[model samples]
Target: METREHYFNRINRFGRISFTIFFVLIFTIPTIVCAAYDIFPGLATVLKATLGLFLILTPIAVSEIVSFVPLLGSGASYLTFETGNVSNIKLPCAMNALKLAGVQPASEEGEVLSTISVAVSSIVTTAVIILAALLLAPLAPVFADPAVKTATANVLPALFGALMVSFLAGGDAGSVVIKGQWKAIILPALVVAVVHYLVFPIKGWEGVTILVLLPVTILGARFLYKKGQITVTPKVAKD
Candidate 1:
């Protein structure tokens, strides 16, 4: 059997190689397109067009790594980032799997389950995408319906609301319950609310806001933990 250290090392190596290949392939598409059309944009023009988005998304990417990696582990993090639709698909899938499996995030069992769940989620997402593409023309009228649009728009909010309820209420069977976690969340939630209402709209500054709030959330949790307000009690097995 491979040692834990060896397993992690192998995962790191694979992640590095795969990410490099993925990066190359991503640029290769545009490179090929430009070459084929002999229509390469000027460097300055390209930078001007992309610089703002790059700035905005870079911090969000870093924040996702900081926030998600611990919960997802090495293998799943790589797979989730590579496959995209992280918040909408990958994260919820992994979290739901962990909850159902009664595994703590960052634990060995959690790592395996997260990886498998993310992999399966990726496969399913790809299949759905292909199916959608094939059905796009046939489904266009249905998709354009106002009710369908409204339902689609609300899907993400509903999904996250359900996830939050499971975590906050500790209602899921076998899911680990952290006592006083809500107290920690109160401080950050208030801060976010204040910022959203008083300072500026959060929608435009989401990435930057998340990066800033991360430290606040950590400090709040730490303070609560130190005060014995936050306790990680082991789940009681049901008879």
Candidate 2:
């Protein structure tokens, strides 16, 4: 008897409440800790310490919500942000689930599957963080080694590289996956190469690598779209 509308309504109602509680907790915890330690400092000092982060993270947060919410739907967005890791774990996990399930993000099945994937990602991330905390003392000496430090420094790069490779390898030529135009691949590759060789060394553009790449991608895609090379075909349901 429950229609998809009713299902989404229920999920949205609960998800809003959950997000509200989490928002309150995040802000409250900072105040609570400051009060307990009597370390409020001055308003200026606090702002000085936090201003850069506030400016940088605010836009990134807004952009991420815009980028991710459509794919995650109502429930999973709340859960994934609360769990705190988005790019590394939550997104890839949800993406893989969608790939396996063969559903478009707007579909009912995609919504449910995305919710489940994010929930599981949250649970696993919590468990891993807890276990790592518990094991930290025992692992300290090993982690203190020079070689270990070097490897730790490279971990993020390696992880991202692997993710990129997986994504590129995922597209079959017949399927024409993910924008599916020569412009999408060749143009971006040239842009990335040029940026790395020429633009990346500029001090002003440092740390906003994604910001640069994103506009280039959109422009490239739009150009292809105008040329009619990029078509809007509905996804075929997998058997």
Candidate 3:
């Protein structure tokens, strides 16, 4: 029986080694390409461009990391960084795995389960991307259709809505806050609406959807929980 400390120790070792490999592979190719072409884009310009990118992405990235870590656990965190689609694909896969296994993502058992699930999802996603690239030409007509385009664009909303519904619908589930669902959903809904309709129109913040809503929703839930409006029993916490 592995203790919690042992699990984290192993995870920490694996994370460092894997990320080192990932970092090397990621940067080495770009450096090699520049050397091959004898065209090093100016250092100052590169730094400037990188700074701009970092400024734009840093807030979103930080928000995502904070929001997702509890749900993803340590090993899944490593896998998630390696895989690009955190919000869209990998998260749902990990959450579903936890749900099926009857474990909370923050639990000791969930760490191993989430890691395995994320690994499988990463493989499938990679394979699908490769297949999509190969079949893109043949599938062009299908993707070109307005219905398909509409469905693709609408999928994210549908996915989140379904997830919210699942969380709210589990009234009998002790882990789910029986009375807390509405405030959690509504406050975030308002926040998202303001961001999308009001702030997004101002330009430069279009990329901030779940990133902003995640914190707002959590804050709202915390407020409700503190006020005794939301009932999350200790038994539920263990769940």
Candidate 4:
């Protein structure tokens, strides 16, 4: 019993420290890098490169942190889902939490903790990340580099495009599938264009595009799902 208590304490401490460090870095690093670039024109290129490197490395860092403790893995996964980025950090974090608790992964208690831990962790992590991002923004001259800002801005649309492509590619290209895919793609674009031109006098065209496309895409996906054209479910077993 004492050993078990000790283990829990250790795990809790680890979780607290890991998340604290993550929040601090997420809040501080980007601003420092951006400010450094602004102060030194020659360093701007290097700073941008560094920022790009950090973006690429962020997933890996999250993965490493989750891998260290399984419960944290689920928390991380929840974070990814909430953040809309699937970088494979969730399950591992959940697994680690279970291990720390001395619970067999197959047990009911283990399963419950895994789910709960991940969900809780995800919520906390997301809030921290968001706060960090907001805090850091004021420190950096992000708007100074129009090109980098534009590229960073495009990341979400690019991710959306990738998601659409993945959905289409995973399914069979039957008549229904093909038609549904095209409709899904075209309809959203059309709605965004029409909305931008007519209904909403939204300031940012991209924001208007997102506002128009989101509902159209959701409705379109449902239409396809109802028609039995695109089965989102996998043919194989889910893990």
Candidate 5:
């Protein structure tokens, strides 16, 4: 039987290898096109065009890795990042799976379930994308309808709101309650709102804002925890 450490080590190795393959494959297509058309942009021009986006996305990427890995586990983190759509699709899927399974995120069972959920989510999302692409022309009018557009626009907020409610209401294993856990978010959320709406007031900077606020949130949570404002109590399981 393989030990847990060995199993995870294997997962890490496979994840790295897979990431490398994907990295190469993603660039290969553009490289082929550029070569075929003899239209290679000089390194400096490419860098100039991408610099701003790279700056904005790099911090967000770092923040996601820092925040998502614990909930997602090793295998799921790699799979979710590689498949993309972490917040909208994979994270929600894994969270729901964990909730349904009543497993703590740091547990072995949770890791396995998270990986399964992410894999299933990826497969389903891919299928949906393909189906939507195929039907796009035929369904253009329906997709363009006012009702559809309105609903589509609100889907993410609605989904995340529901998730927030679930998380706040349901404790780990539906038994261990972390009292005053919501208070931890108060500071971070306030900061983000103030910066986003009052100060910066710009779109597409939320990720950068979050990266900056990460430490604030962590410190606030730690302070609350140390102050005994947040306390964890396990519920007595019934027979």
Candidate 6:
């Protein structure tokens, strides 16, 4: 049997190793691949565009996702890496990116207000863009052929596959390799996949799949927490 000290040491080591691998796989690999692709010729231009877009759109996405499931809002925020005081609203990176992109800043007071205003405007802009896309979807024939539409639909699955590969490449791969975490990952994944494809087809309720699965995920997480199976501690100070 494992001693308590041995368990603690293993947990700490695994935590560090897991997060280090996670960061390398998620961020570093993506950066390296993008660089290799030469998708954007100029690094400076790409950086500016990426920062500006992330800053302007992330908050909006956070808000929308939170609105769907208020209980998971904190999780969503954590996933998106949002920082700074939301009330005071400082977006330094975004501001700098905008400036680099030749967008003039407003006055000092305007800078503070601009952040809030832009975040709010982002929601409206996203909605308009979605609506415009939906309206124009019927004109797909005029813009692109059936082959292009099929390719566009496949992008989501491609991204999902990449994410799965990344997760497995860096996550508790040792445990999973030994089949310890396979049940955990497979159960949830199968539930989600089945609900998305099969249940939605039969029931015609896309949102119901999320509603059914999220609670199951939460319950599974609680079970894991109780059994000392999963531990996710925040980097912030705890009271």
C-alpha lDDT score of every prediction, in listed order: 0.86, 0.74, 0.79, 0.55, 0.87, 0.47
Prediction RMSDs, each to the true structure? 2.3, 4.1, 3.7, 15.2, 2.3, 21.0
The candidate with the higher TM-score, 2 or 4, is 2
- Residues 154-217, candidate 6: write the lDDT tens digits: 8657755654554433222211221123234655677877866776562324334445566676
Q: Single out the weakest 10-residue window by summed lDDT for candidate 3.
A: 169-178
- Encode model 1's per-residue lDDT on 1-239: one tens digit a residue: 99888988998899889989999999999999999999999999999999998998788898888888998999999999999988888999999999888777888788889999999999999998899899999999988999999998999899988998767654333445577676767887899999899988898676677678889989999988999988876667789
What are the runs in model 1 whose C-alpha is more than 4 Å off? 171-177, 235-239
lDDT per residue as tens, model 5, 62-133: 878887898899999999999999888898989989988888787788888999999999999999999999
**Candidate 6, residue 97: lDDT:** 32
Better of 3 and 5 by lDDT: 5
Give the clash total for candidate 6: 0
Instruction: Give the local distance difference test score of model 1.
Output: 0.86
* Candidate 2 lDDT (Cα, 0 to 1): 0.74
Clash count list over all predictions: 0, 0, 0, 17, 0, 0
- lDDT, residue 64, candidate 3: 71
Candidates in order, TM-scores: namely 0.90, 0.74, 0.81, 0.31, 0.88, 0.34
| TM-score for predicted model 3 compared with the true structure | 0.81
Off by over 4 Å in 6: 1-67, 71-142, 162-185, 192-203, 233-239
In terms of lDDT, the poorest run of 10 residues in model 4 is 170-179
